[model samples]
Target: MQESVFCMVVSRTRLIQAIACFLSLYKTMDNFKVYILCVDEKCYEFLKKINFDKIVLVTISELNREDLLAIKASRKLNQYCWTLKPGFIKYILTLEESIKRVTYIDSDLFFYQNPNVIFENQPYDSVLLSSGEVFLPMYSKEVNNTIQSLTGNFNSGFISFKKDIDGLSCVNWWDKMCVDSCTSNPEDNKFGDQKYLDDMPFLFNNVYEITTQGVNIGHWNSSKYKFTVLNDTIMVNNNKLIFYHFSGFRIISKYDIRQVHEQDRVNTPFIYQIYRRALEKIINDVEKIDPDFKGYFTVDAVDDN
Candidate 1:
Protein backbone atom coordinates (compact mmCIF):
# COMPACT_ATOMS: atom_id res chain seq x y z
CA MET A 1 0.00 0.00 0.00
CA GLN A 2 1.26 3.45 -0.82
CA GLU A 3 1.73 5.58 2.28
CA SER A 4 -0.22 8.79 2.50
CA VAL A 5 1.70 11.67 4.08
CA PHE A 6 -0.07 14.44 6.02
CA CYS A 7 1.04 17.40 8.16
CA MET A 8 -0.58 19.79 10.64
CA VAL A 9 0.48 22.73 12.83
CA VAL A 10 -0.85 22.81 16.39
CA SER A 11 -0.47 24.76 19.63
CA ARG A 12 -1.78 24.39 23.19
CA THR A 13 -4.98 26.30 22.37
CA ARG A 14 -5.82 23.74 19.68
CA LEU A 15 -4.38 20.64 21.38
CA ILE A 16 -7.72 18.94 22.03
CA GLN A 17 -9.03 19.59 18.54
CA ALA A 18 -5.79 18.31 16.99
CA ILE A 19 -5.99 15.03 18.94
CA ALA A 20 -9.61 14.61 17.92
CA CYS A 21 -8.59 15.12 14.31
CA PHE A 22 -5.84 12.52 14.59
CA LEU A 23 -8.20 9.95 16.15
CA SER A 24 -10.71 10.48 13.38
CA LEU A 25 -8.01 10.02 10.76
CA TYR A 26 -6.74 6.88 12.49
CA LYS A 27 -10.21 5.39 12.44
CA THR A 28 -10.62 5.96 8.70
CA MET A 29 -7.24 5.93 7.01
CA ASP A 30 -4.76 3.08 6.46
CA ASN A 31 -1.02 3.30 5.73
CA PHE A 32 -0.74 6.98 6.50
CA LYS A 33 1.72 9.15 8.47
CA VAL A 34 0.98 12.49 10.09
CA TYR A 35 3.73 15.01 10.85
CA ILE A 36 2.51 17.41 13.53
CA LEU A 37 4.37 20.72 13.96
CA CYS A 38 3.91 21.72 17.57
CA VAL A 39 4.02 25.50 17.76
CA ASP A 40 4.48 25.57 21.55
CA GLU A 41 6.52 23.57 24.05
CA LYS A 42 3.48 22.52 26.08
CA CYS A 43 1.80 20.98 23.05
CA TYR A 44 5.00 19.20 22.10
CA GLU A 45 5.52 17.77 25.60
CA PHE A 46 1.92 16.62 25.93
CA LEU A 47 1.86 14.91 22.51
CA LYS A 48 5.24 13.31 23.30
CA LYS A 49 3.70 11.56 26.30
CA ILE A 50 0.74 10.27 24.28
CA ASN A 51 3.04 9.14 21.44
CA PHE A 52 0.28 8.35 19.00
CA ASP A 53 0.94 5.67 16.39
CA LYS A 54 1.79 6.71 12.80
CA ILE A 55 2.53 10.22 14.02
CA VAL A 56 5.84 12.13 14.06
CA LEU A 57 5.99 15.18 16.31
CA VAL A 58 8.04 18.25 15.29
CA THR A 59 8.77 21.54 17.03
CA ILE A 60 9.06 25.13 15.83
CA SER A 61 12.72 25.08 16.75
CA GLU A 62 13.22 22.16 14.37
CA LEU A 63 12.50 24.51 11.49
CA ASN A 64 15.56 26.57 12.42
CA ARG A 65 15.04 29.18 9.70
CA GLU A 66 16.38 32.65 10.26
CA ASP A 67 13.51 34.27 8.33
CA LEU A 68 10.80 32.61 10.46
CA LEU A 69 12.58 33.38 13.73
CA ALA A 70 13.10 37.03 12.81
CA ILE A 71 9.35 37.59 12.28
CA LYS A 72 8.24 35.57 15.31
CA ALA A 73 8.04 38.64 17.48
CA SER A 74 6.27 40.73 14.85
CA ARG A 75 3.44 38.36 13.88
CA LYS A 76 0.44 37.48 16.05
CA LEU A 77 0.17 33.91 17.33
CA ASN A 78 -2.57 32.91 14.87
CA GLN A 79 -0.82 34.58 11.96
CA TYR A 80 2.44 32.94 12.92
CA CYS A 81 0.73 29.54 12.84
CA TRP A 82 -0.77 30.35 9.46
CA THR A 83 2.64 31.43 8.22
CA LEU A 84 4.11 28.05 9.14
CA LYS A 85 1.62 25.99 7.11
CA PRO A 86 3.42 26.09 3.77
CA GLY A 87 6.85 26.02 5.37
CA PHE A 88 5.90 22.99 7.44
CA ILE A 89 4.66 21.11 4.38
CA LYS A 90 7.79 22.02 2.49
CA TYR A 91 9.89 20.81 5.40
CA ILE A 92 8.21 17.39 5.40
CA LEU A 93 8.44 17.00 1.64
CA THR A 94 12.19 17.58 1.85
CA LEU A 95 12.70 15.25 4.82
CA GLU A 96 11.93 12.11 2.77
CA GLU A 97 12.76 11.52 -0.86
CA SER A 98 10.31 8.60 -0.94
CA ILE A 99 7.36 10.77 0.08
CA LYS A 100 5.51 11.23 -3.23
CA ARG A 101 2.87 13.58 -1.90
CA VAL A 102 2.24 15.70 1.20
CA THR A 103 -1.15 17.00 2.28
CA TYR A 104 -1.42 19.86 4.76
CA ILE A 105 -4.50 19.77 6.99
CA ASP A 106 -5.71 22.13 9.68
CA SER A 107 -5.78 20.80 13.23
CA ASP A 108 -9.55 21.34 13.52
CA LEU A 109 -10.48 19.04 10.61
CA PHE A 110 -12.13 15.68 11.44
CA PHE A 111 -12.30 12.89 8.88
CA TYR A 112 -15.25 10.52 8.46
CA GLN A 113 -13.92 8.41 5.59
CA ASN A 114 -10.72 7.64 3.70
CA PRO A 115 -9.43 10.84 2.08
CA ASN A 116 -8.10 8.98 -0.98
CA VAL A 117 -11.39 9.90 -2.61
CA ILE A 118 -10.09 13.46 -2.82
CA PHE A 119 -7.10 12.23 -4.80
CA GLU A 120 -9.05 10.23 -7.34
CA ASN A 121 -8.58 11.34 -10.96
CA GLN A 122 -6.03 13.89 -9.73
CA PRO A 123 -2.81 13.86 -11.71
CA TYR A 124 0.27 12.83 -9.73
CA ASP A 125 2.01 16.07 -10.66
CA SER A 126 -0.95 18.34 -9.97
CA VAL A 127 -1.47 20.53 -6.93
CA LEU A 128 -4.83 20.00 -5.17
CA LEU A 129 -6.60 22.96 -3.59
CA SER A 130 -9.82 22.95 -1.58
CA SER A 131 -12.47 25.21 -3.05
CA GLY A 132 -13.92 27.86 -0.72
CA GLU A 133 -17.07 28.25 -2.74
CA VAL A 134 -20.02 28.92 -0.43
CA PHE A 135 -23.07 27.12 -1.87
CA LEU A 136 -25.56 29.55 -0.33
CA PRO A 137 -27.33 31.64 -2.97
CA MET A 138 -28.68 34.10 -0.44
CA TYR A 139 -25.60 36.29 -0.73
CA SER A 140 -25.60 38.94 -3.45
CA LYS A 141 -22.85 39.20 -6.04
CA GLU A 142 -21.20 42.02 -4.13
CA VAL A 143 -21.20 40.06 -0.90
CA ASN A 144 -19.87 36.98 -2.63
CA ASN A 145 -17.12 38.95 -4.32
CA THR A 146 -16.17 40.57 -1.02
CA ILE A 147 -15.93 37.20 0.69
CA GLN A 148 -13.79 35.84 -2.15
CA SER A 149 -11.45 38.82 -2.07
CA LEU A 150 -11.04 38.57 1.68
CA THR A 151 -10.80 34.80 2.14
CA GLY A 152 -9.68 33.87 -1.38
CA ASN A 153 -11.35 31.43 -3.80
CA PHE A 154 -9.66 28.45 -2.13
CA ASN A 155 -9.52 27.28 1.46
CA SER A 156 -6.02 26.70 2.82
CA GLY A 157 -7.20 24.23 5.47
CA PHE A 158 -6.52 21.19 3.23
CA ILE A 159 -4.02 21.26 0.38
CA SER A 160 -2.15 18.44 -1.34
CA PHE A 161 1.24 18.82 -3.00
CA LYS A 162 2.86 16.22 -5.17
CA LYS A 163 6.65 15.90 -5.05
CA ASP A 164 7.09 17.11 -8.63
CA ILE A 165 8.19 20.23 -10.44
CA ASP A 166 4.79 21.96 -10.46
CA GLY A 167 3.99 21.10 -6.84
CA LEU A 168 7.42 22.15 -5.56
CA SER A 169 7.23 25.45 -7.42
CA CYS A 170 3.77 26.20 -6.02
CA VAL A 171 4.69 25.41 -2.41
CA ASN A 172 7.99 27.28 -2.67
CA TRP A 173 6.25 30.40 -3.94
CA TRP A 174 3.66 30.15 -1.17
CA ASP A 175 6.34 29.70 1.50
CA LYS A 176 8.21 32.75 0.27
CA MET A 177 5.02 34.86 0.13
CA CYS A 178 4.03 33.84 3.65
CA VAL A 179 7.49 34.45 5.06
CA ASP A 180 7.60 37.89 3.50
CA SER A 181 4.14 39.06 4.57
CA CYS A 182 1.35 36.97 6.08
CA THR A 183 -0.90 39.49 7.75
CA SER A 184 -4.64 39.41 8.43
CA ASN A 185 -5.07 42.90 7.03
CA PRO A 186 -7.38 42.77 4.00
CA GLU A 187 -6.49 46.34 3.09
CA ASP A 188 -3.25 45.06 1.58
CA ASN A 189 -5.16 42.26 -0.20
CA LYS A 190 -3.80 39.70 2.24
CA PHE A 191 -5.67 37.62 4.78
CA GLY A 192 -3.02 35.54 6.47
CA ASP A 193 -1.66 32.75 4.27
CA GLN A 194 -5.07 32.00 2.73
CA LYS A 195 -5.51 34.86 0.26
CA TYR A 196 -2.18 34.12 -1.39
CA LEU A 197 -3.84 31.05 -2.93
CA ASP A 198 -5.98 33.22 -5.12
CA ASP A 199 -3.12 33.59 -7.58
CA MET A 200 -2.17 29.90 -7.78
CA PRO A 201 -4.16 28.94 -10.85
CA PHE A 202 -2.97 31.99 -12.71
CA LEU A 203 0.60 31.58 -11.61
CA PHE A 204 1.12 27.87 -12.15
CA ASN A 205 0.13 24.95 -14.34
CA ASN A 206 -1.37 21.68 -12.99
CA VAL A 207 -3.29 23.52 -10.27
CA TYR A 208 -6.76 22.07 -9.78
CA GLU A 209 -9.51 22.90 -7.30
CA ILE A 210 -11.01 19.90 -5.53
CA THR A 211 -14.65 19.71 -6.63
CA THR A 212 -15.60 16.82 -4.36
CA GLN A 213 -18.65 18.00 -2.43
CA GLY A 214 -18.10 16.16 0.84
CA VAL A 215 -14.34 16.76 0.93
CA ASN A 216 -14.53 20.06 2.83
CA ILE A 217 -18.05 20.30 4.24
CA GLY A 218 -17.87 23.01 6.86
CA HIS A 219 -19.78 25.87 8.49
CA TRP A 220 -19.29 28.27 5.58
CA ASN A 221 -21.22 26.01 3.21
CA SER A 222 -23.00 23.43 5.40
CA SER A 223 -26.26 25.38 5.23
CA LYS A 224 -26.58 24.77 1.52
CA TYR A 225 -26.60 20.96 1.75
CA LYS A 226 -29.18 18.52 3.05
CA PHE A 227 -27.41 16.16 5.42
CA THR A 228 -28.79 12.74 6.39
CA VAL A 229 -27.57 9.72 8.31
CA LEU A 230 -28.25 6.36 6.67
CA ASN A 231 -27.11 2.94 7.86
CA ASP A 232 -24.57 4.50 10.24
CA THR A 233 -23.14 6.65 7.51
CA ILE A 234 -23.38 10.44 7.36
CA MET A 235 -24.26 11.67 3.86
CA VAL A 236 -24.20 15.19 2.54
CA ASN A 237 -26.57 15.53 -0.45
CA ASN A 238 -26.28 11.78 -1.11
CA ASN A 239 -22.47 11.86 -0.94
CA LYS A 240 -20.60 10.24 1.95
CA LEU A 241 -19.15 12.90 4.20
CA ILE A 242 -15.38 12.69 3.82
CA PHE A 243 -14.45 15.26 6.45
CA TYR A 244 -15.81 18.25 8.31
CA HIS A 245 -13.87 21.38 9.19
CA PHE A 246 -14.89 22.60 12.63
CA SER A 247 -13.73 26.11 11.78
CA GLY A 248 -15.40 28.19 14.48
CA PHE A 249 -16.85 25.51 16.75
CA ARG A 250 -15.82 26.25 20.34
CA ILE A 251 -15.83 24.23 23.52
CA ILE A 252 -17.19 26.42 26.31
CA SER A 253 -16.97 23.58 28.84
CA LYS A 254 -16.79 19.83 29.10
CA TYR A 255 -20.52 19.40 28.58
CA ASP A 256 -21.23 22.47 26.50
CA ILE A 257 -20.00 23.23 22.97
CA ARG A 258 -20.93 26.47 21.30
CA GLN A 259 -21.74 26.00 17.63
CA VAL A 260 -20.68 29.25 16.04
CA HIS A 261 -22.54 28.59 12.80
CA GLU A 262 -26.26 29.01 13.37
CA GLN A 263 -27.24 26.93 10.33
CA ASP A 264 -25.24 23.91 11.54
CA ARG A 265 -27.30 23.74 14.75
CA VAL A 266 -30.46 23.30 12.69
CA ASN A 267 -29.11 21.27 9.75
CA THR A 268 -26.44 19.07 11.31
CA PRO A 269 -27.23 18.55 14.99
CA PHE A 270 -26.48 14.83 14.64
CA ILE A 271 -23.01 15.62 13.25
CA TYR A 272 -22.31 17.99 16.13
CA GLN A 273 -23.37 15.33 18.62
CA ILE A 274 -20.88 12.89 17.10
CA TYR A 275 -18.09 15.46 17.35
CA ARG A 276 -19.08 16.38 20.93
CA ARG A 277 -18.86 12.77 22.04
CA ALA A 278 -15.52 12.33 20.29
CA LEU A 279 -14.17 15.48 21.96
CA GLU A 280 -15.40 14.33 25.39
CA LYS A 281 -13.61 11.01 24.97
CA ILE A 282 -10.46 12.77 23.78
CA ILE A 283 -10.59 15.08 26.78
CA ASN A 284 -10.90 12.09 29.11
CA ASP A 285 -7.88 10.43 27.48
CA VAL A 286 -5.86 13.65 27.67
CA GLU A 287 -6.67 14.07 31.35
CA LYS A 288 -5.24 10.61 31.95
CA ILE A 289 -1.93 11.84 30.54
CA ASP A 290 -2.04 15.11 32.46
CA PRO A 291 -4.70 15.73 35.07
CA ASP A 292 -4.05 19.46 35.11
CA PHE A 293 -4.17 19.76 31.31
CA LYS A 294 -6.72 22.48 30.73
CA GLY A 295 -6.51 23.90 27.24
CA TYR A 296 -8.92 25.08 24.51
CA PHE A 297 -11.88 25.59 26.88
CA THR A 298 -13.41 29.00 26.26
CA VAL A 299 -15.06 31.21 28.89
CA ASP A 300 -17.23 33.09 26.38
CA ALA A 301 -20.96 33.06 27.17
CA VAL A 302 -23.06 31.15 24.64
CA ASP A 303 -25.72 33.25 22.97
CA ASP A 304 -28.79 31.28 22.00
CA ASN A 305 -30.41 34.30 20.49
Candidate 2:
Protein backbone atom coordinates (compact mmCIF):
# COMPACT_ATOMS: atom_id res chain seq x y z
CA MET A 1 0.00 0.00 0.00
CA GLN A 2 1.14 3.58 -0.63
CA GLU A 3 1.74 5.94 2.30
CA SER A 4 0.65 9.61 2.77
CA VAL A 5 1.18 12.41 5.30
CA PHE A 6 -1.32 14.42 7.40
CA CYS A 7 -0.89 17.72 9.29
CA MET A 8 -2.67 19.48 12.16
CA VAL A 9 -1.89 22.46 14.39
CA VAL A 10 -1.85 21.79 18.14
CA SER A 11 -0.91 23.68 21.28
CA ARG A 12 -0.35 23.23 24.99
CA THR A 13 -3.74 24.90 25.32
CA ARG A 14 -5.36 21.78 23.85
CA LEU A 15 -2.65 19.31 24.76
CA ILE A 16 -4.89 16.59 26.19
CA GLN A 17 -7.25 16.68 23.21
CA ALA A 18 -4.23 16.49 20.92
CA ILE A 19 -3.09 13.37 22.75
CA ALA A 20 -6.50 11.77 22.34
CA CYS A 21 -6.56 12.79 18.67
CA PHE A 22 -3.20 11.13 18.03
CA LEU A 23 -3.94 7.96 20.02
CA SER A 24 -7.34 7.57 18.38
CA LEU A 25 -5.93 8.00 14.88
CA TYR A 26 -3.15 5.46 15.49
CA LYS A 27 -5.64 3.01 16.97
CA THR A 28 -8.10 3.48 14.13
CA MET A 29 -5.79 3.61 11.08
CA ASP A 30 -2.45 2.17 9.97
CA ASN A 31 -2.19 3.66 6.48
CA PHE A 32 -1.61 7.44 6.74
CA LYS A 33 1.37 9.27 8.30
CA VAL A 34 1.21 12.35 10.63
CA TYR A 35 3.04 15.63 11.22
CA ILE A 36 1.85 18.14 13.81
CA LEU A 37 2.70 21.87 14.07
CA CYS A 38 3.25 22.15 17.82
CA VAL A 39 2.07 25.64 18.75
CA ASP A 40 4.40 25.90 21.73
CA GLU A 41 7.51 24.42 23.30
CA LYS A 42 5.84 22.33 25.99
CA CYS A 43 3.55 20.51 23.57
CA TYR A 44 6.45 19.71 21.26
CA GLU A 45 8.50 18.36 24.18
CA PHE A 46 5.64 16.19 25.43
CA LEU A 47 4.87 14.72 21.98
CA LYS A 48 8.50 13.85 21.29
CA LYS A 49 8.40 11.28 24.07
CA ILE A 50 5.43 9.43 22.55
CA ASN A 51 7.78 8.59 19.65
CA PHE A 52 5.66 6.63 17.21
CA ASP A 53 7.55 5.96 13.97
CA LYS A 54 4.60 7.18 11.94
CA ILE A 55 4.51 10.48 13.86
CA VAL A 56 6.70 13.50 13.14
CA LEU A 57 6.59 16.46 15.53
CA VAL A 58 7.15 20.01 14.21
CA THR A 59 7.27 23.32 16.09
CA ILE A 60 6.37 26.92 15.23
CA SER A 61 9.85 28.16 16.00
CA GLU A 62 11.25 25.52 13.67
CA LEU A 63 9.07 26.79 10.84
CA ASN A 64 11.07 30.03 11.27
CA ARG A 65 8.41 32.43 10.05
CA GLU A 66 8.93 35.73 11.83
CA ASP A 67 5.84 37.09 10.07
CA LEU A 68 3.48 34.47 11.60
CA LEU A 69 5.14 35.02 14.95
CA ALA A 70 4.23 38.68 14.65
CA ILE A 71 0.72 37.88 13.54
CA LYS A 72 0.27 35.60 16.55
CA ALA A 73 0.40 38.59 18.88
CA SER A 74 -2.61 40.21 17.19
CA ARG A 75 -5.00 37.27 16.85
CA LYS A 76 -7.27 35.46 19.30
CA LEU A 77 -6.60 31.77 19.91
CA ASN A 78 -9.22 30.51 17.45
CA GLN A 79 -8.22 33.10 14.88
CA TYR A 80 -4.56 32.20 15.37
CA CYS A 81 -5.13 28.49 14.75
CA TRP A 82 -7.29 29.02 11.70
CA THR A 83 -4.91 31.50 10.13
CA LEU A 84 -2.05 29.03 10.29
CA LYS A 85 -3.85 26.16 8.55
CA PRO A 86 -3.15 26.94 4.91
CA GLY A 87 0.37 28.27 5.30
CA PHE A 88 1.32 25.39 7.56
CA ILE A 89 -0.09 22.75 5.17
CA LYS A 90 1.86 24.25 2.32
CA TYR A 91 4.97 24.51 4.47
CA ILE A 92 4.70 20.84 5.43
CA LEU A 93 4.45 19.69 1.82
CA THR A 94 7.47 21.78 0.78
CA LEU A 95 9.64 20.61 3.67
CA GLU A 96 10.24 17.11 2.30
CA GLU A 97 10.83 15.65 -1.14
CA SER A 98 9.20 12.32 -0.20
CA ILE A 99 6.04 14.10 0.93
CA LYS A 100 3.85 14.16 -2.19
CA ARG A 101 0.46 14.61 -0.49
CA VAL A 102 -0.85 16.04 2.79
CA THR A 103 -4.23 16.13 4.48
CA TYR A 104 -5.15 18.76 7.08
CA ILE A 105 -7.39 17.67 9.96
CA ASP A 106 -8.28 19.28 13.28
CA SER A 107 -6.70 18.02 16.50
CA ASP A 108 -10.09 17.58 18.24
CA LEU A 109 -11.24 14.86 15.80
CA PHE A 110 -11.42 11.24 16.99
CA PHE A 111 -11.64 8.30 14.64
CA TYR A 112 -13.88 5.24 14.80
CA GLN A 113 -12.42 3.50 11.72
CA ASN A 114 -9.40 3.54 9.44
CA PRO A 115 -9.16 7.06 7.94
CA ASN A 116 -7.24 5.43 5.13
CA VAL A 117 -10.60 4.01 4.12
CA ILE A 118 -11.28 7.61 3.04
CA PHE A 119 -7.76 8.35 1.82
CA GLU A 120 -7.23 5.11 -0.07
CA ASN A 121 -10.32 5.81 -2.11
CA GLN A 122 -9.58 9.54 -2.55
CA PRO A 123 -9.48 10.97 -6.09
CA TYR A 124 -5.68 11.34 -5.91
CA ASP A 125 -5.37 13.87 -8.72
CA SER A 126 -7.72 16.36 -7.04
CA VAL A 127 -7.85 18.55 -3.94
CA LEU A 128 -10.45 17.09 -1.55
CA LEU A 129 -12.86 18.64 1.00
CA SER A 130 -16.07 17.60 2.84
CA SER A 131 -19.41 19.25 3.41
CA GLY A 132 -20.75 20.05 6.88
CA GLU A 133 -24.02 18.74 8.35
CA VAL A 134 -25.23 22.33 8.26
CA PHE A 135 -27.12 21.44 5.08
CA LEU A 136 -29.38 18.88 6.81
CA PRO A 137 -33.03 19.68 7.47
CA MET A 138 -32.60 18.37 11.02
CA TYR A 139 -30.02 21.13 11.41
CA SER A 140 -32.47 23.81 10.36
CA LYS A 141 -31.64 26.15 13.24
CA GLU A 142 -31.17 29.84 12.35
CA VAL A 143 -27.52 29.86 13.44
CA ASN A 144 -26.59 26.78 11.40
CA ASN A 145 -28.42 28.13 8.40
CA THR A 146 -26.77 31.54 8.62
CA ILE A 147 -23.26 30.14 8.92
CA GLN A 148 -23.84 27.67 6.08
CA SER A 149 -25.13 30.47 3.91
CA LEU A 150 -21.90 32.41 4.49
CA THR A 151 -19.40 29.55 4.40
CA GLY A 152 -20.85 27.81 1.37
CA ASN A 153 -21.59 24.27 2.62
CA PHE A 154 -18.08 23.10 3.53
CA ASN A 155 -16.10 22.19 6.62
CA SER A 156 -12.33 22.60 6.72
CA GLY A 157 -11.75 20.05 9.46
CA PHE A 158 -10.47 17.58 6.84
CA ILE A 159 -8.83 18.63 3.52
CA SER A 160 -6.34 16.73 1.36
CA PHE A 161 -4.27 17.48 -1.73
CA LYS A 162 -1.53 16.17 -3.99
CA LYS A 163 1.84 18.01 -4.39
CA ASP A 164 1.43 18.64 -8.09
CA ILE A 165 0.77 21.94 -9.93
CA ASP A 166 -2.97 22.10 -9.31
CA GLY A 167 -2.59 21.41 -5.58
CA LEU A 168 0.28 23.90 -5.26
CA SER A 169 -1.79 26.57 -6.98
CA CYS A 170 -4.53 26.04 -4.35
CA VAL A 171 -1.93 26.07 -1.60
CA ASN A 172 -0.50 29.40 -2.77
CA TRP A 173 -3.91 31.02 -3.12
CA TRP A 174 -5.19 29.81 0.24
CA ASP A 175 -1.96 30.65 2.04
CA LYS A 176 -2.12 34.20 0.68
CA MET A 177 -5.65 34.73 2.01
CA CYS A 178 -5.00 33.30 5.49
CA VAL A 179 -1.75 35.18 5.85
CA ASP A 180 -3.24 38.44 4.61
CA SER A 181 -6.22 38.48 6.98
CA CYS A 182 -8.07 35.60 8.66
CA THR A 183 -10.81 36.32 11.14
CA SER A 184 -14.14 35.09 12.52
CA ASN A 185 -15.89 37.78 10.47
CA PRO A 186 -18.20 36.12 7.95
CA GLU A 187 -19.40 39.38 6.39
CA ASP A 188 -16.31 39.68 4.23
CA ASN A 189 -16.90 36.30 2.61
CA LYS A 190 -14.18 34.63 4.70
CA PHE A 191 -14.62 32.67 7.88
CA GLY A 192 -10.98 31.84 8.32
CA ASP A 193 -9.45 29.06 6.19
CA GLN A 194 -12.65 27.05 5.75
CA LYS A 195 -14.70 29.65 3.93
CA TYR A 196 -11.84 30.48 1.61
CA LEU A 197 -12.30 26.91 0.39
CA ASP A 198 -15.62 27.96 -1.07
CA ASP A 199 -13.69 29.68 -3.82
CA MET A 200 -11.38 26.69 -4.36
CA PRO A 201 -13.44 24.65 -6.84
CA PHE A 202 -13.90 27.68 -9.02
CA LEU A 203 -10.28 28.84 -8.94
CA PHE A 204 -8.40 25.56 -8.93
CA ASN A 205 -8.50 22.39 -11.03
CA ASN A 206 -9.48 18.93 -9.76
CA VAL A 207 -11.19 20.00 -6.53
CA TYR A 208 -13.44 17.27 -5.06
CA GLU A 209 -15.99 17.49 -2.25
CA ILE A 210 -16.84 14.44 -0.12
CA THR A 211 -20.55 13.65 -0.36
CA THR A 212 -20.50 10.39 1.61
CA GLN A 213 -22.82 11.03 4.58
CA GLY A 214 -20.95 9.15 7.27
CA VAL A 215 -17.42 10.51 6.86
CA ASN A 216 -17.19 13.68 8.95
CA ILE A 217 -19.95 13.37 11.52
CA GLY A 218 -19.45 16.00 14.21
CA HIS A 219 -21.24 17.87 17.03
CA TRP A 220 -22.53 20.52 14.64
CA ASN A 221 -24.54 18.04 12.56
CA SER A 222 -24.28 14.69 14.38
CA SER A 223 -27.73 15.11 15.97
CA LYS A 224 -29.10 14.48 12.47
CA TYR A 225 -27.66 10.95 12.28
CA LYS A 226 -29.09 7.79 13.82
CA PHE A 227 -26.37 5.86 15.61
CA THR A 228 -26.47 2.25 16.84
CA VAL A 229 -23.89 0.07 18.51
CA LEU A 230 -23.70 -3.44 17.16
CA ASN A 231 -20.88 -5.85 18.13
CA ASP A 232 -19.09 -2.92 19.81
CA THR A 233 -18.97 -0.88 16.61
CA ILE A 234 -20.68 2.49 16.33
CA MET A 235 -22.71 2.75 13.16
CA VAL A 236 -24.31 5.96 11.94
CA ASN A 237 -26.98 5.67 9.25
CA ASN A 238 -25.95 1.96 9.24
CA ASN A 239 -22.47 2.91 8.06
CA LYS A 240 -19.29 2.77 10.17
CA LEU A 241 -18.50 6.29 11.44
CA ILE A 242 -15.13 7.51 10.18
CA PHE A 243 -14.47 10.33 12.67
CA TYR A 244 -16.37 12.74 14.90
CA HIS A 245 -15.37 16.39 15.22
CA PHE A 246 -15.54 17.36 18.89
CA SER A 247 -15.23 21.04 17.91
CA GLY A 248 -16.81 22.81 20.87
CA PHE A 249 -16.39 20.13 23.53
CA ARG A 250 -14.83 21.89 26.51
CA ILE A 251 -13.91 21.12 30.09
CA ILE A 252 -16.17 23.26 32.24
CA SER A 253 -14.78 21.91 35.50
CA LYS A 254 -12.16 19.53 36.87
CA TYR A 255 -14.15 16.47 35.84
CA ASP A 256 -16.77 17.81 33.50
CA ILE A 257 -16.92 18.46 29.75
CA ARG A 258 -19.76 20.28 28.06
CA GLN A 259 -20.83 20.70 24.47
CA VAL A 260 -20.98 24.49 24.43
CA HIS A 261 -22.04 24.94 20.81
CA GLU A 262 -24.89 22.40 20.60
CA GLN A 263 -27.69 23.29 22.98
CA ASP A 264 -29.43 19.91 22.69
CA ARG A 265 -26.42 17.59 22.86
CA VAL A 266 -27.35 16.02 26.22
CA ASN A 267 -28.43 12.59 24.90
CA THR A 268 -26.82 12.78 21.50
CA PRO A 269 -25.30 9.28 21.45
CA PHE A 270 -23.22 6.80 23.46
CA ILE A 271 -20.43 7.31 20.92
CA TYR A 272 -19.94 10.75 22.46
CA GLN A 273 -18.72 9.36 25.78
CA ILE A 274 -16.44 6.86 24.03
CA TYR A 275 -14.45 9.75 22.52
CA ARG A 276 -14.88 11.62 25.79
CA ARG A 277 -13.08 8.90 27.72
CA ALA A 278 -10.18 9.09 25.30
CA LEU A 279 -9.87 12.87 25.90
CA GLU A 280 -10.34 12.53 29.68
CA LYS A 281 -7.59 9.88 29.82
CA ILE A 282 -5.19 12.28 28.14
CA ILE A 283 -6.21 15.00 30.59
CA ASN A 284 -5.38 12.60 33.40
CA ASP A 285 -2.00 12.03 31.74
CA VAL A 286 -1.32 15.78 31.67
CA GLU A 287 -2.29 16.14 35.33
CA LYS A 288 0.32 13.52 36.19
CA ILE A 289 2.89 15.51 34.25
CA ASP A 290 2.16 18.44 36.55
CA PRO A 291 -0.19 18.59 39.48
CA ASP A 292 -0.84 22.20 38.40
CA PHE A 293 -0.84 22.06 34.63
CA LYS A 294 -3.13 24.88 33.54
CA GLY A 295 -3.62 23.37 30.13
CA TYR A 296 -7.27 24.29 29.88
CA PHE A 297 -8.34 27.28 27.80
CA THR A 298 -10.27 26.12 24.76
CA VAL A 299 -10.88 22.78 26.41
CA ASP A 300 -11.33 25.43 29.07
CA ALA A 301 -11.24 23.89 32.53
CA VAL A 302 -12.91 26.54 34.67
CA ASP A 303 -10.66 28.39 37.06
CA ASP A 304 -11.19 26.55 40.34
CA ASN A 305 -9.69 29.38 42.34
Judged by TM-score, which candidate is best? Answer: 1
Best by lDDT: 1
Please list the C-alpha lDDT of all candidates, in the order they appear: 0.82, 0.76
Candidate 1 lDDT tens digits, 1-305? 23459999997877888999998888898778999999889999999998899999998889878888789899877789988999998898888778888999998899999998788757554699998876555678788678777778788999999888898899999999999888867658887898889899889989989876688777767777777888988898889899988887666656766667553354464687788888888888888879888676446423210
Task: Evaluate model 1: give its TM-score.
Answer: 0.92
TM-score, one value per model: 0.92, 0.90
lDDT at residue 141 of model 1 (Cα atoms): 73
**CA deviation > 4 Å runs, candidate 2:** 135-144, 298-305
lDDT, model 2 = 0.76
lDDT of 2 at 100: 81
True lDDT of residue 287, candidate 2: 76
At residue 155, candidate 2 shows an lDDT of: 85
